[model samples]
Target: MAMYAYKDAARTVKILARDAQKQDKSNRYYCPNHKCDAHMFIRNIEGVSASYFGAIHSHGHINNCPHGASNRFNPNDYDEDTFEFDNALLALTMPGMSQTKKELPGEHGSGNAKASPPRTIRQIYSMCKAHDCSDTYNGVKIGKMLLDNRSVYMYPKGVFGWRIIEAKCKRPHFYNSIKKEISLIASTAGEEYTFILKFESEKLFKEIKNVIFLNRECFTVVAGQWSSSGTFNVFCTTFLSKKQLAIIN
Candidate 1:
């Protein structure tokens, strides 16, 4: 999940805090999922929170789970405390929250966003696995960043609609040279075909928010950080595009 998606995720961590507070050595928090214990060391995450967020941080030593042989998280056993924790944590998950139009499916203007030129649904699933694929994702990180920040996964949902038009100008001069007719857009996605931009060279190094043309319509560039230092070039563009496979809301 995008970190921005969890701007309020810390609220859910509080729920984990309450549920974890009462347990002693004989009782430690474990994964509720019967099949996965490797991910049970959630307290490891808590320690970092304490050092950064506030005064509360329980070293795994205090919980006594010792990597295995621990009790599982059973929400049925707790009230007010766990409830807050679960809800707060859930806030960060798709299961825990509702979708807003702002997060449009990205691959193909399906309302989401990404780095590579948008893709078709059939194509997205073909490449799905671990980092690029959805079925094999395990959210481990390097430093503070999830290794797969550029990835996108969509659950089943109802009909989605949009168009995709992309154009890139490698040279800043080329950007100025493009005519308004080349930039102004149709009244809606349904009215146009693919508009792909592949500019060859660009001079600027700053992030782009949105590019405005002669027309009032807008194409937003979602901000993301790179994993390594590299000079990237190009003035970009996109129209609209859509694919439908997400069944979950």
Candidate 2:
């Protein structure tokens, strides 16, 4: 089951099943994976608790698409160092900086090889969820962080890298188009915390706004440097990108 799907055939816009159900049924939906050409349809069972995008049996996902199967992620199935970062600092930078490097002439066949694709915020979030937030890869701790007074003391300068912030509120609490700011609530250990995310670019803000509007009850995995001023004053830095945010159920 997929939580998101492309709104159009061009796949530039994303739509969640909850919002898609309100749209005209004539509209077509595509696989969330851009690399896949599979067609999808909104699935809202009569007694199910949630709705999701399901792939049509006739138009299954491509062989390599991660969403092709519903199997749970098992870290033991792969090499322990599979998710290790080559350069932790570089990976914590902006999105474009973590792209795979091109291979030289003899690099393909020789011991030297091309770099692997950089991990996305969603991929890291998946690992955290699978391990219940106790797994650590390359010195980076993957776990839940409370948005309370203790968090401010722990990360005064803010958190760097991909981190999961469990949503406490079902919907966004605040939005400011002029300042490009959005505020949301997060929870850990039963305590709720609030944080504001300010987008530096209009393009990025619009993309995030679209997701927030569509999936009001989902949580977010944020990438970049997060800073806290007081117990309730937490926000992100300008070092963020569209790829740094993954809003999921």
Candidate 3:
């Protein structure tokens, strides 16, 4: 009774929603009932809980909406609808991050130059925290320095590696080819963090699937974007890996 499909600010556009509600730009969201004219607005159902999309009026035409009256609605369906709507908005809002290329700090040569040593996860985290990370409205600094499609070298020196902690995929894989994964990771200073990794690749995906089947705690190196989160989202993943995971440096 607290979910609806709607457009976001960039008009890109769920829950038991746990994240802090930000500056939501969309004013009107569609009701689940196809024939209902009752629209919804973001409101805090519980005094201290995260905000959800609910009917503006407490007692009115909204009471007739399928989501408003809440006889027996499917939670999965609501989640799916919201996921698709949000992804469309995201595609419109985020720049083509996955298609761009940038130079990293630790590279060695220009002409026939040796490849720079891959920065460990801790090193990357240290650099990002100092330069690229920013504090969101939720009062937490989110990591944004990692490139989406580039190779990220992670070392098993400390507590860094992929560990399946939870599944944060909010949308159906059919909506977009991308897959969302949640894993336990650590920064350079040995501080632990959980992040969401959104990616799409046949080979890498299959490799992860195989590793998951074999072991959830494989100490393999990976490369992908380290995206930040607002609230409910918490998956950061890398699709690339080094041939050898031993820490040579």
Candidate 4:
């Protein structure tokens, strides 16, 4: 059993089970399933991944709740599909069916739709782990700077729904020649996020060139750091594992 979704008093965000404990227990967080009455405030079990919102526990839910480990009513067996956390997070962020059609989905687009502004890394991190964020601030020298300046630092953990487009020439200093940078974009679901790879002649860059850049409409993930302005600092690029990009077509 795992907690697939949660709604705090102020915000509704999909999260891992470990994060549920951070919510304010007074108002508490709730499971996403409408019929599931299980509250994550009580359901959360620290260090135990199996215990989550929607998991079967002492406090039971109605028949319609899907969190039951096994379907007693159904005699036949079915395949249990697996999904990455990012995909689940994306689903939780999306608007419901009752929302206006113009809102649609994705991080961006829809001129009339008032989408939440893109959050900085600090903001995203803060939202996901409010309790730990203060600790994160104390651990890094730049943390104080971030708080003081209201700047967001991006240490890219991964990218989704984007594929390599091409390498492009960026302006260079007066004494230097133009620099090469890779480019990618994700457009599905109306969210538009562009990636500009800071070029390096490393093995990872070569792999991206040979595998992702060469292929059309391929999805890729990346790990890297971003400047305060939210630009991907290609120099800080980190290669993602095969597993991270495997789910993408």
Candidate 1 lDDT (Cα, whole model)? 0.21
The 10-residue segment of model 2 with minimum total lDDT is: 103-112
lDDT (10s digit) by residue, model 3, range 13-49: 4212223254442456554344555556655533333
Alpha-carbon shift of residue 124 in model 3 (angstroms)? 9.7
Q: Candidate 4, TM-score vs. the true structure?
A: 0.29
How do the residues 1-249 of candidate 1 rate in per-residue lDDT, one tens digit apiece?
111010121322222322233242123233322233322222323222210011123422223221122222211111212222122222322222343433423322232213231122222221121111121212322111111112211211110122111222222232333431122111222222212222222321111212332211322111111121121221123211112111110
Regions of candidate 3 where Cα sits further than 4 Å from its true position = 1-182, 185-192, 232-249
- Candidate that scores best on TM-score: 2
lDDT tens digits, residues 130-214, model 4?
2221222223322222211112122233232311111122223111113444454433232333555555445544555556544
TM-score of each: 0.18, 0.50, 0.24, 0.29
**Model 2 per-residue lDDT tens digits across residues 1-249:** 455677777877767555666454555588756788877777665454345566778888887454554322323222325455424323644656543323211112122233232255544444344331232444444442222222433444454433445443334356678988777765545444555677788887777777776776656545544566355535444535665566665
Off by over 4 Å in 1: 1-19, 22-26, 32-35, 39-249
**Which lDDT values do the candidates have, in the order given?**
0.21, 0.52, 0.33, 0.33
lDDT of 4 at 166: 17
TM-score of 3: 0.24
Write the number of the candidate with greater lDDT, choosing between 2 and 3.
Answer: 2
Q: Could you tell me which 10 consecutive residues in candidate 1 have the lowest summed lDDT?
A: 1-10
Best by lDDT: 2
Error of 2 at 139 (Å): 4.8
Stretches off by above 4 angstroms in model 2 are: 1-72, 76-118, 144-162, 168-172, 188-190, 230-233
- List all candidate RMSDs to the true structure: 18.7, 14.5, 21.3, 17.2
| Candidate number that wins on TM-score, 2 or 3 | 2
